[model samples]
Target: MLGRVLGGISTSLFFATFECWMVAEHRRCGFGEELLRYMFGLMFSVQYLAAIGAGLVAQAAASVVPLTRLSASSSWHYGGYTAPFDISLACLLLAIPAIQMSWTENYGNNKAGAAGTGIAASLRAGARAMGSSWQVPILGLAVATFEGSMYCFVFNWTPALDAGGGLPPPHGLIFSSFMMACMCGSSFFGMLDSSYRPVKVLLPVILTAAAALGLTALSLARGSTSNGAVFAGFLIFEACVGAYFPCVGTVKSEVVPEEARAGVYNVYRVPLNAFVIFLLLTDISPATQFGACCCLLSVAAGAVWLLGRVEQTR
Candidate 1:
């Protein structure tokens, strides 16, 4: 429960930071075409890597410590060790505005061309660039919603599958393998993106359909005489989830303005919070109903992709 709370808080802080960073970057870049490319490659790399390190350290500490002890202390005191992880997180959150200030000083005042615009003008230009595109904002919302729903379904269903469906420990391994497949899928998609506009990419729809098929197979296997079919369906479903993930971020980046990319990316997080509340409050059968929900979400995601394309054409 504490983990969930902390995770939510952390996610919120992360998005807040991202939004601030986006606005700052826009102010700094003066609506430059390649602002996102620059920010993602340089600034975001540092921020994300720091976040990853923090997560790893936190995980390692939790693994070694007793949960009760950790919760008992006001600080992050666990077992026999006391570390400043909480303090560090707090400090990181506080540092976001400072980081923005630094970015503003560095790039916000620079003249890119003969326009000789001030930082305020640059920010306005960036805002205008973002406001020019409706596709970016809608796609951003869709990506966030899809991701939040996916996480909720996965978290709620996995344990239910283990208990209700009688899936063994090996099922966890299968899930991990599915994640690896997703990494591969993302790499494949990146390569494809080099040759095509990400919005024109059809992989999201294809993968969504595949995921739906997998879920449908699982649903059909619920009353099956053979367990093999059910297990295979689970594996297929997981793989499809993995394959579809890359498209979510790609779509966001493709549609959002260069300056507002981070802010738009952060907006994708709302679905996650909403989904958690949904899972907690709802009394649905995890395996059967949740699988149906997954299928429905996949269909909806595919429809979103199609609608985005139609909007693009018009």
Candidate 2:
């Protein structure tokens, strides 16, 4: 129970802290918004590489202390597969010094700011901020549907890969490949952003994502067991996942006020969380679930389309 609680806190912090810091730090240093897009794309690309590296490191650590049922999925190793946890602790401790050396502490809104004082007030301020701005809610809708679809993919991929009745698909290798695709995606975003605005970049990405998901869902619905085709579709969506983070981050930095950034940003997660639960909780088949995902992404694409229209009018 305690470990789960601690893990949940860790997950929340991981999602929230570094991105907030990046935005705040960027503004503090007086960097151009042009540069901000580059930084976000670069950050995600490197972050994806680091995640791959961390997986390699964890696997190496697990080898030194092998588990009873070890194959490809070394991540789930138990019975004193504790080496990764130790490494995690050491890395976290190392980050303390890294933060001290590289980061300067900054504050958000003061007591008199729009975010006000106290958690309750901050949350209320976030709600108001989200409602007040068309951009914020549209962005929130994108996060809910797009991010929710990403989570659905995560849940579905294992059963997806294993369906072909072969040597139980190399789970670890597949995960690493997915990460590499995401890395490519972030780099792709950087290149595209150099020529086009993030808003412009997002519309096609969302539409392509919807198309890819629609294909995947249609394949499953038709009972096609062609693993290669389905896997390709899955990879396409994963690539879209990579592009999504930086694009959303760049736009979010523009729309959400810094004083209420964290609060309003966290608000996006509320619908996102509910979206995931609703999708995953149903008793539907993978085809149905993925069809639902495709529908959701279509909605997100519409929202982004409207956002683009509004941006043009502005």
Candidate 3:
């Protein structure tokens, strides 16, 4: 109990410190638009690195330290063994809010003098408009659904394809390679000018096609299909899904006002968490079925694209 309490407090403090640092960074840079974008990218990269490092450390520790020894020393049962790690991860995720709060406060307080009342009023008005709009909520749900589905498919599909479809390890390697393709896609998308509207780029149609391909791959797996065909389909699907990220980021930025963007992004996380819980509760066959359901959801997301395009036209 004491260790858990201490861990939580320590994690919160670390997050608070990181947030303060991010805020200071924003202020020191004078919140220049280009600077903010680069900062966000850098922070994202750093966070990913931190996550990787933490995972490696946890894996190493698990390998060397017997669970029995740790359990005995920590007075934990098998059921409660994962709690410490969970608490640590919770602390790590809290850094996101800390950083957001810091940046928000910096903009709200420091930049107020320069923009004066008009800028503040505009921000307030945007917030109010956002609060009253169903569009933001709907867009958020679409984004969350897409994100959750992609994660579920990736996590569940690889093993299913290996076991059920008789695909070898090479297929899994192909999936990783497809992820690398996505990294390239992200870099390509990032290079495009901010003036380029992602919706106009036909991201919805591309995502819909990807979902179709994913479903096709699953169907092939179910039908005892050839490994080559299934692998090729998976690769194509993963590549397209990888390309979807930049468009999603751009859409989120365009739809949500800057002041409200963080809050809106946070709200999207709720559905993602719910989806993860749903995945956890599902059996293997059910998880595969859920992936198929996600493919259908992607078709629905394409409809969201039409709605978004209409809004853009307006």
Candidate 4:
């Protein structure tokens, strides 16, 4: 249904092809998961470069056109085909040769015919994998809890700030700064040892996360705190979050079974989605919600330590 709405039959076909290729890539990259995960972090950092460019374009567009008028319309191209769309088309065209020239390696040389089990069997296998390792779901939930809190802020920060002492309305500048921090964090964490043992690295990252969330709770608690202080706390939190992606990705790669990686990851999102929904449905203040996030991060740090112990024992 969504595919039909997006680009009719063409989008559906594109997605079908995309997923098939992606699963192949996933299998090839499964063994060196940490390195693959680190590469993804670097890729994300590159994506943020695109984001910065987009923001600049948007800002420039705003300067020439009144935001009020721009916001009133859904179409940015009343003048017919837009330059952005043209550039997108050209990029897609160029990517064909780029992809062909890209590095290709697969650690596992299993026959392509043995790529997957039957759907029913695969589903059953995935279910079994969920219970096969406590480390998988436990670490997954812990990471999700921490990330879900960050996403809550991403979606609600503007209103959350507005509610607390009439802090200034949200602007693009704050979001751009947060993305910059995230990029830096990803780059920094990517340089860490790409070992399967993530406990040593994750321990400090999670602890820092807890401390940052604690500060956020504190900043929000004091209604009299200057908005600058609150904003700074948020920035610090974002900076810590930079390392979170590669760290958690490494942990997930360490524990998640190769056959069930996709299914297990989807299961991991259940708790995260539920957590965010609960927060959004309630009328709780940002401080209260942030305090809750702090507790979750604290629990996650402990769980991560225990997970490390389990890994070492094995």
Candidate 5:
């Protein structure tokens, strides 16, 4: 339980704090928005590549250990002493020096006090900031709806592949493939963002994602065993996932004030977590759940379109 709590805290720090720091630094340096978009693309592309490499290293470490939980879990040595957590620790240790030596510590200008406000205070401010503009809440709507669908993809992808009677899917290999597809999407973002605004780009991205998931859900609902079609659809969805991170970041960076950036950014995860937790508590069919995601994406597309209109007027 303590480990999970720590992990949750770490996840928040990773997604919120690191991004807040980078964007603050970028603005401090006075770079162009074009450059910021480029950095987002390059950063995520490299991060995906690192994920692939880390997965490979972890698999190598895991396979070295004796299999103990084979009957109960497809993952044998995971979370064991010989698992990737050791490598994760080592990597974190290595990162400490690089960060301490090279990176400057950045903080949000919390007007509440120099000592800073607590989580609840930050969230309250974030919520208030959301109310201040049409774009903020609309951006939040886009994030919540799209990411609500995305978390479903994260949990369902492996089972969707494994349902066909066959050898268990190579989990690591499949993950690496997904990351590569995301890298492709990231590269695509770099190319497109150079020409089009991120808001404009998100319209087709959300639509393509919706279509991909819709097709896959249709197949699953029909009791079809065509894994090829499902895999193709999933890859398409992941590419959209790659495009979304930088695009969403760029959009939010434009709309959300820096003072409330991390707070509001973290607040966007509220609905996503709630959606995922509700799904976890329910016994809904995967096809039904995934189809629900398609519907939500349609809603997100509408939101994005309206946001585009709003952006045009502004």
Candidate 6:
């Protein structure tokens, strides 16, 4: 219990600190940032795609024939559990020089101003500024809910498949396929014309995602759908997940005032982190949780559609 609590806090703090700053830095790029941002998104997708694909192959091969360069005993081996981390640490060490060479002056310091005296005061002021516009909070809520659902899927999809769909362990095939689909999704969205507004594009994507989630939930609950069908449904949903980062970033740049962007972004994380933790703690069946996600996605779709209509007026 204590470990879970600490893990959640540590995860939340790391994301709130690092992720928010990353977004802020992207925003500071000024012109053509959307293209750059989504390009970065595409790079991220490719990175994961390759990593997941490699991991799938390695794990599958290890399952068939365990590799043991260093072994405590016959049953204990290095390949499956320990070798990956060693490789990762080695890669991290190798990248340090490149990372140092690429480092730039902190862009966040430029955004920081005397909005208030301290962190608390700055948060209060940012909140007040955001509250002055209803759209800010509404958009924040919608994005948070949407992002939270994606995170839930990230954490639970494998277990859900194993327990409810009769899928077994070592889900490399499914994971890699999803990552590949995500890569295609991100690339497609990144290439779309800039004439289209972010909110307008998101409305339909959100609706499609909700429909996919609903189908997936039904498949999980009834077991009428084949594994292929379940996988297809999730692939479609993963495409939407890929587009979501760029779309929400576009909306944030448009709707959020410049001064409060960082604070409001962190504020949005509150509901997202909260929802994820709630779902994590729950003992409900996977099908039931997926059904709940369908409902939540439906609401989020409606909210984003309304937000789009309002954005048209502005």
**TM-score, cand. 4 vs. native:** 0.73
Lowest summed lDDT window (length 10), candidate 4: 11-20
Better model by TM-score, 1 or 5? 5
Residue-by-residue lDDT tens digits, candidate 5, 1-314: 99888987887788787778878889888888789988989899999999888777776776677545656656644443367777889999998899899987665454446356678877987998989999998888889899989988888887888886578776666788888889999889987737798999999999999999999999888888768888899999999999998898888888999888878988988887787778757878778888989998999999999999998898
Residue pairs with backbone atoms closer than 3 Å in model 4 (clashes): none
Over the stretch 4-93, how does candidate 1's per-residue lDDT look in tens digits? 798777776565445445545555556753444334333433443354455455545544655444465466444422433554667668
Name every residue pair that clashes in candidate 1.
136-255, 144-268
lDDT-based ranking: 5, 2, 6, 4, 3, 1
> Worst 10-residue stretch by lDDT in candidate 3?
12-21
Ranked by lDDT, the better of candidates 2 and 5 is 5
lDDT of each: 0.51, 0.80, 0.53, 0.65, 0.84, 0.70
Top candidate, metric TM-score: 5
TM-score of 2: 0.87
Best by lDDT: 5
For residue 23, model 3's alpha carbon misses the true position, in angstroms, by 12
Which consecutive 10 residues in model 5 have the weakest lDDT in total? 73-82
C-alpha TM-scores of all predictions: 0.56, 0.87, 0.57, 0.73, 0.90, 0.79
In candidate 6, stretches whose alpha carbon ends up further than 4 angstroms from where it belongs are 1-30, 33-54, 57-78, 81-86, 91-97, 108-126, 164-169
Ranked by lDDT, the better of candidates 3 and 6 is 6
Off by over 4 Å in 2: 1-4, 58-66, 69-90, 108-116, 193-195
Instruction: Write down the lDDT that model 2 would get.
Output: 0.80
